[model samples]
Target: MPHRSELYEDIPSVCWPIVYSPDYNITFMGLEKLHPFDAGKWGKVINFLKEEKLIGDDLIVQAREATDEDLLVVHTRRYLNKLKAGKLAVDRGWAINVGGGFHHCSSDKGGGFCAYADITLAIKFLFERVPGVSKATIIDLDAHQGNGHERDFMDDQKVYIMDVYNRYIYPGDGFAKRAIKRKVELEWGTEDTEYLQKVHTHVEGALNELKPDIIVYNAGTDILDGDPLGGLAISPQGIVKRDEVVFKAARSRRIPILMVTSGGYQKRTARIIADSILNLHNLGLIDKELVASEAENSKVEKMIRDSVTDLTNLSL
Candidate 1:
């Protein structure tokens, strides 16, 4: 089996599979205005969830930063980085990593502001360490093509990729396009109606075509109507509905799924993410058995929380 990893910890049933860490947020000065991605949004999403009383800090799993050994599962030695939450997905029926989705990164190279291949790592970890998880399907809904995972799994038949992206946008890599089993290229300003319809059709078709052991849903909100980089135009409501479509499909098939919030440039993107998770709970797609006991007060957990709070003040 793969070398023992702390990533595959025995999670308490009282906690939801949703994974996050305070270090997930990247805040440095006031640069959130200049970049195409809101670096501080991850923490904001957690705060929104807290505001809604959907979950408490101890009720969600605390994600550990992937060590170099953990990253080597799917990354090149020269390009190693961090990721996890796959094993958690298998333990629970589903999981959502509030701070990943680097679709522009591959094992050998990183591009479009994405520095590591998190999605690729998540799948490979499962195939190597978890039984009955040999096959995986990647449903990438970012406005930009998920060239990173595509390149990493190019010749691997055990992996299936369904990408929906704007044809005119960045990283228009034709070579990477070949790896996508189901590709939906969109026009400029493609609104909710056309975007959602095509996504729904391709998602269902892809799932129908192959029943994989697990699903990796790369939910990138950069497709929101006015994103400077993403040329497509999809409304926030459309984005929520799109996530619902994917979750419903995975639930219906009883397949374990891991979701990564990949990209979204707008300031409101964090709220949208928390809203989608809440919507999923509202629809009965994801739920937790709230234990009557109060939250665990482990010393290690307190240390991690304090460390992350300090790191969030620094640049990522």
Candidate 2:
């Protein structure tokens, strides 16, 4: 049968930073509130894509608000109850901010930064609704580990998680795990070349091992050189190249991906992430936007391969 587009079909390009801040309110994660960081940054990106004529009016910008049931997929009933009670402000593990952040959320509870639903909700939504979409692999490249996702899918064999996080930090729980934890930890003050090498290595591994039907990409921009929360110092060009690498890999493998922007505390986050996503759209990895021409596509292919080789050989 020929492929058909679903929710992402009508909308050639949609940006999701529409959910109100209260939906992600967390008081214990030490980080500030959600603010307009996601939306504001995403808006800049979409506008650029539109100006570049990469997207059309048919694109649907769905505001993803997580329901209680969505949260229940990987969380426990007791923890769910705490969240509903609004008393999650006290416990570090259940605290909304901690779990809300997207980095530290575990299966039943939350950690360092993850508070509520981010990739988990998207994955569940896609899995339950989309046909022939059973298995998934979460590609998380935030400066911090995707501890929440790793723990959530630890025993489920249905989900494969490949994370590239810093070697040391808060909520240190990624190493020495029983599952397929492709944890690539860069030394503090790591540079961009070293970062991309690890991303390429593990991403290649994920393609071979899990053989996922879909990919949930946590396109975090915090790994950039001057990010407020991240430890690495990747150049802006390096970050854009990284996204191209990820998107190309998915496309070559014939995998469909649902991208959810995760981390990136730089003041210029919106611009950076927007550019990266545009690059992804340009490469035809995401169906929401127009694909590049043969010549442009060839350039992207070379850039990704060359950058990956450079990254792999860096001394770090």
Candidate 3:
């Protein structure tokens, strides 16, 4: 028998496919401010969504910290993905874990502030537990190379990885590049026009090549024009458009997608992330299924309650 874990709990139907928690914000006595990456950005994204009235507190799925056993599930193999986010995606058709896209962390090592191989773990979990989910595709659009997962899934033919990152940045793992089925390395200060065009072509091509069961979209905002480490010239609107393109491809193909906010160094990264999600909703790419499912379940629940009330009144 497989070990049961708290990270795999069923969420309420009324909740949106977005998964987050306040604990994901790590503030070590305001050191997060000094740090290049904004550790507290996850909460800021949630706040932005709340201000827009796009999502409610009750409609958000809370994420719990993984225990030792849960960590072991990720460790049993090479590298691991976020198990909770993976489970949520399998059930909801699409899910976004606002805080998890630890692409630089493998099972045994850590780099670029990434401590866990959530992307790899998620893919592995789905293949093991979810039926009809034998294959996975990782569309890693982070600013830096996702060497961690590339190293982990190097030999796995079932997982197809397409990584688009700045070729000049951190962890240029020559060994890891062997895993990327489709690698699109970008130059410093690459802008949106060429970036978006290439993204569309490669995404379309990757899916057409081998349709996978799940799409793990590593949507990193560090590609913003002024990001210090990202070294890309993409605007806020461009980031939003990029997300839309990936989501559209997944939805059109009816492939379940799991998105994770990977790397963004600026303070405004949270706002842009929220804006991208809102754009996705505006495009009708997400949230419809959850709303319809909740309505149907609510009707059934009310009928059960009414029947019980009628029985009690008759007994009286």
Candidate 4:
């Protein structure tokens, strides 16, 4: 018997780094563009795949700014009110600098690395408009803590979040809650193998326990070897390996994943990271083309299986 074609259907990924523009300046001085590194790499990945005829739609845009009611799905009314007025709580450090990540922002104020809400709004938009995708499983793998997401989904059972961040790091609140289904807090020198192991466990649990309809992968690359913010020492290959691991896990479950390049300060690091994730999307296209090639079907299957075996055996 032949193996079943378990890949997700032909779907165009919805991304906002290119279309959505924010007015705030990033913490770094030279990074003075809306959506910064993400949009550029997003274009590169999409363009490369399109030129190769791997993906059809050439649209490289983010959605228009979300409305206040859309944001209310995950944020508190009081917090939103204060953010619009630039008011801050005494304890909360500052408002979210760019878009949503309001987990750290308290009900009465703002804090952590978020400004105007975006993630929650995006989730709401997709849930409402995108047919067959009812709930989302957010996989936030940023080096820094995803404090905002952990906070926002604290009580909501609909959204399942599996955040992997540094323990006792800045905005040290992503793990001290009950909302997250899995929280892997790495120390300063977490090795790649250990990190991948935890990711495998978390993704497996999410699939078995939560059984999400759609997956939104926060493909943050700050965990690279020399990232100023990340303490973990992951090489470029290490980062790529982690991405392949995540994708393979999702593929095995036959899940449709919408990848959001979450965070990565370094440009080169960001490029490589985006390429690895987007490569999977491209690979999906190649596999789709192979569906009609009965004569060459066995060869493609061998290639995919061998590749999978190699990736699964590697450390980190």
lDDT per model vs. reference = 0.76, 0.53, 0.77, 0.50
Candidate 4 minimal-lDDT segment of 10 residues: 88-97
Query: Model 4, range 1-316, lDDT digits (tens) per residue?
Result: 2122211122232311222122221334545454333434434444454565534444322223333454454457866676552211100000011222333443334554456434554454445444454667878787876666556666767788888887756667625356777877888877788888887888888778876655656667778766666777677777777777777776666554444444565667645744564555465521433223432545533333222211100000
TM-score per candidate, chains pooled: 0.87, 0.69, 0.87, 0.64
Backbone clashes in each candidate structure, one number apiece?
Answer: 0, 20, 7, 7
User: In model 3, which regions exceed 4 Å deviation?
Assistant: 76-91, 288-316
Q: Estimate, for each residue in 121-182, the C-alpha lDDT of model 1 and write its tens digit.
A: 77776666555667889999988999999999999999999999999988999999999999
Instruction: Looking at model 3, report the run of 10 residues with the lowest lDDT sum.
Output: 307-316
Q: Pairs clashing in candidate 3?
A: 80-120, 80-121, 81-118, 81-120, 81-121, 81-122, 82-118
RMSD of each: 7.2, 10.7, 9.1, 11.9
Candidate 4 regions exceeding 4 Å error are 1-58, 72-110, 126-134, 174-176, 285-316
| Local accuracy of candidate 3 as per-residue lDDT tens digits, 133-219 | 678899999999999889888898999999999999898999999999999999999999999999999999999999987788999
| Candidate number with greatest lDDT | 3
Cα lDDT of candidate 3 equals 0.77
**lDDT tens per residue, model 2, 1-316:** 3122121222111422111122233344644455423434444555555676755434323233334554555567777776642111110000001112364666567655455544554455445544555787878777777777666666777788787777676557734244445767678888867778878878988888777866666767778887767778998888888878887787677554445556766557666765775665566455422222222555533332222111100000
